[model samples]
Target: MTGAAERMRDRQMTDGMALNPAGPDLAEAMPPGVLREIEPRHLEEPRGRYHGHAGLLAAPHNVEEVAAVVRACAAARIGIVPLGGGTGLVGGQIMQDGPLPLLLSLERMHAVRDVYPQENVMIAEAGVTLQSARDAAKDSDRLFPLSLASQGSAQIGGVLSTNAGGVNALRYGTARALCLGIEAVLPDGSIMHDLKRLRKDNTGYDLRDLLIGAEGSLGIITAASLRLVPPPAANGVALIVVPDPAAALDLLSLAGRQLGDCVTAFELISGQGPRFQMEKMPDLRQPFDSAPDWMVLIEIGLPRGLEPDTALEALFEAAAEAGLALDGLIAQSGQQAADFWRLREEIPEANRLIGAISSHDISLPLSEVPGFIEDAGAMLADMGNMRINCFGHLGDGNLHYNVFPAKGRDRAEYDDIRKRIQASVHEMVVARGGSFSAEHGVGRLKVADLERWGDPARLQAMRAIKAALDPLGIMNPGAVLA
Candidate 1:
């Protein structure tokens, strides 16, 4: 098909389409190797808490094939559920048994299309993993700061779609903030190429922003232009032992005032968390004693000309004088800094391996964090039997409120009580003028919660947009919205 003809056809598909749109013949769409090559390794899968909703699906290698497949599915009225890495904790990626959906993965679109170093932007296909983008940036003496534990396999599209916020959110911002523009395939197979490197543009509507955290409910992101930053010249890392969360908050304000924007990371690690990790991971050693109750993993990164060490030293000294920090250790080398960060990043994984957990990713007002911790901790304990590993971007007041039950308890049994626990936590969070979800987007896991607690007018507007863009509701139906 000619480019213009293809584009015209795409536009036509968007019109007069039923909620259950008719699709092309699926038999001819499949290439020979696409399904026939599924041998032993392809079929062999690990036995885990597998979501029975959606079954396994193949990844598309290129945009043309992916778009074609989606178009055909849309025509057939099959729900198109976009997948990437399949590492989503929420039930978003699960293929449910009813109204069977076609899972379209961008894993094969793993290509670095272009890197515009001069413009401080890079264009990568949807399937390009986060680690690959970071490597590309490093090669050009720039930095792509959107990072997380799943970066090794988490594709750019999924990250941006979910609007993932990782460790560096304090400075560089989240996936949404890092993105310049996106190129996505609409539900009708139309390519909305808004990929531009301009720093500022007030065109009609910023359509790219709609798709950023849409969780693939609107369209399938094909490629994106991501903003980059200059590599930090110096990194100062210090793990401070604080008396409690209140003191950690105090130290955060102190460091923020003293260090200004250079305070890149202010991570709160429960004293019990590190103790758990030390016990779990034999190779990882504990840096401090077990009596502090709460510890702060603070980081300060400066530009090339600034003296990071001197600035950090001053902050620590002031913190000590105020009795906010009990003791501290500064990482003098890169290896030591990595160790400090590992302690913070691996907490969730470490806790997961430990046993049962009813996790909550919530955010509250910065001033209310300390109180929320103290009060919520007691409340959770009062509810029944659970231990809370409360930590996260303390600077931003986001807390990963994970509830781990007593050891050896069956987590499946707690599933029935999941709603009650979530309601308790969410009620407390909302009372503090906080959000139910902080970093993670409202995937299938939180859809009902979103409907209940979400602002009605806001939901109406979102539904209007969804109806306009994907009237068929074939793109990730029952996700983010009911």
Candidate 2:
């Protein structure tokens, strides 16, 4: 299994067979109390797109146990699929059609190791939920701006592993940018203790960044030193109706001109979003009397002396004068701000309830966004009778462009054309120099997409690194690579 020939053959069989079966040998090698019974949740992903098989479930209590479990799995040649919150949409946590991997769950490692307020850093275990991390930061009067709707369940390890980009990405950046260091176990079960709290280190080869978004292919991130920001003195939210995607983009430019870094988040919402919410989630209140064709949700954070509402009103007036804004609402209170955000955050869940024939998390150049949306919508309409819910962090060019069946039709009926729809969308995205997989890492779902659209030299280097680190190809088989 260590030879080059064996490695090449193993890559071919990553989704086909296990190199070696480790039913009893792996069991005997596990640390006591580390081998728990596999649960249904560990094998299921958020979108119900992938279901995996687990020969063993190892819930390591700490990094030492985590290393030991990895070492044992390496010895047995058993593929190891690291499990965190299991909230990933792209099936990174699941290993369908591969070897019955050892499911490595870090839920037991949930602990905020330390918080150094002076350094503006928090050292937290991989299993700690994002909500818990945020709560800890708040206790010290700081802010953890890396947010997601799944924050209540998405663990820190998976967040960094995926290098997630939430709404605040316009201001705070992605998970990779926010992380200072990490404590991880390499594929060979050796630990890399690079979890330093310092902001700058010019060390050789930055493996911390390598593992951050590797999607558990290179190694397991057991813990991290995450960067935290100071809470803004004043904050405001506004929902401004734009005539179209073009106007929304223009409004974004205007907001940038006026607010600069104070503009924390700028989200684009299609009218389909509010309609879907009304149809599926009847109890959740709508922000507008009627669903506008398009709108932009803006949030600004200012220094102590500035008034957020005043700033927003002035910005809206400028936008109206420029003919970029039709109507808008500035949050008068904190509850109203939360409600505005709720309208933006709940779109994904509503889309899920309605079921999607095809979903894309794609990103493009800022200027290309409006054009891509309009062209994509026209193309999709010609393809089939489908509804589009195109929305996401517009400030960052990441769009959760999802397609659903038309009214009174089930998504199951569109199965035949689903593959074509995804391929067409990705083709357009790549032709325009956009990425098929944006914030979400390339899990089992997008491996083919990666192979098709991935840059040749970059993909070669990635494969070389994978082979060098994981010679046996046992870490998350059939993921990230072929």
Candidate 3:
């Protein structure tokens, strides 16, 4: 079945049709103000990894308009790569080496269709940015907890499509858990309007889940009914110096025992990230005079009367007594809290400036994380004198373990060993029963890794499902699957 599906997709690709920028096919089919000239930004993705091939850009103002564009692409046998905010780290939003696809941008469709404060739900168009959704939820006295560094630019549809996991995932869960139902345009341009606010609906096959993290291989999500929660009465942030990753794990256990689910985010940071920031972006405020060997950014949101500062202080004291934490500073004001978060958020930008030889977003079982880190570091050290920046949501077992060159050296110097380093790190992760790709979906960049490490039975099932849903393979072709 999979072989036949692949042949069918290949046959469709051979159908003589070219995506012309000024062609009448798109101009005649799209609604006024929807079709626009493709810009350089539309063809580029974050990380400067992939430069997509998009001849024309279309910003649909409504779901019907999106359907019309999809229908036109289907009829023309052209590929459709859905674009949203252009902030995805993965190459999912970009078609780097394929036929010039119809870049379907959802920017114009940004809208909060409805907000039900009582039901703790908000129906938002896919074009709505994550920050916009969070702001709207706050205005309605609710919380949309899918928080990420790229929240300002990442749209809801893209977030749902990748099933993004951020710091708050330790408490609130990822995009999949936050979404109730979604309205989408299928590969055949048919509308799947299943946007319900219900908490429980065991009706039939979960098409919503299927489309959420499929990277648009199955369909293009138009809008979603997002799950919201009551805003925490009191929240505080603290930066604590930890001895090492093992100590960080110990502190995490202590915090969970003390605060339980009130612990919103527990991030592990290495001295390398801070040092890089200080070198590249000294203008940003640093929480400490010097970068410590390791630190943990702990955030807690407590109910009314359970003072967050007091709870954090107690946790700190307990952690210190347990030898898990050395020293810590808790934010006294909102500005201070924001300052602490700013430092954490700016590390990625700093990494970009330094230029990494190889970067990995991996997750390990809670118990295996410390061991994997130690073993991986030793393995890399054996290969070369490389600097490693290991950091991420420790509470969730996800780490952005990146490798770079030694002092005064460029990453290009280590070009020969980039693939070896990535493979070594990923092999350690998988051997320890972890995942090579955690929060980031298997976009075009990681399709090879997925094929290499993905379970055979699971991969087979995914291909079959893709064939069943997107037989022509027009929806984000060559994304999750090769």
**Highest TM-score model number:** 2
- Runs of candidate 2 with Cα error greater than 4 angstroms are 1-18
> Model 1, range 1-482, lDDT digits (tens) per residue?
32322332353366554333222345356443332222232222121333533332546676666677777766676677787766666656653434445667687788898888888899999988999999998888889998787889788998999888988898889898999998888889887878898889998899899899999999999899999988889889998888888899899889878888888888988876776686677677667656357888888879889877788778888998999988888888899889888888778767877664577889999899988988888887777777677889887788888887665565666777777888988988989999998888787667767877899999999988988988776888767886
Against the unseen true structure, what C-alpha lDDT does each candidate score?
0.77, 0.90, 0.89
TM-score, per-candidate, Cα-based? 0.90, 0.97, 0.96
lDDT score for candidate 3 against the true structure: 0.89
lDDT of each residue in 1-482, candidate 2, tens digit only: 21322443465577453456547779989999988888788888887887777888889999999999888888778888889999999888987664467889999999999999989999999999999999999999999899898999999999999999999999999999999999999989999998899887997899999998999999999999999999999999999999998898899989899998999999999999999999999989898888999999999999999999999999999999999999999999999999999999899889989999999999999999988998999999999899999999999999999999999999999999999999999999999989998898888788888878899999999999998999888888777887
> Model 1: clashing residue pairs?
21-75, 22-75, 22-76, 23-75, 23-76, 53-95, 53-96, 54-95, 54-96
In model 1, the Cα lDDT at residue 62 comes to: 69
Instruction: Write the number of the candidate with greater TM-score, choosing between 2 and 3.
Output: 2
In order of lDDT, best first, we have: 2, 3, 1
Poorest stretch of ten by lDDT in candidate 1? 38-47
Give the count of colliding residue pairs in each prediction.
Answer: 9, 0, 0
User: TM-score for model 3?
Assistant: 0.96
lDDT-wise, the better of 1 and 2 is: 2
lDDT (Cα, 0-100) at 195 in candidate 1: 87
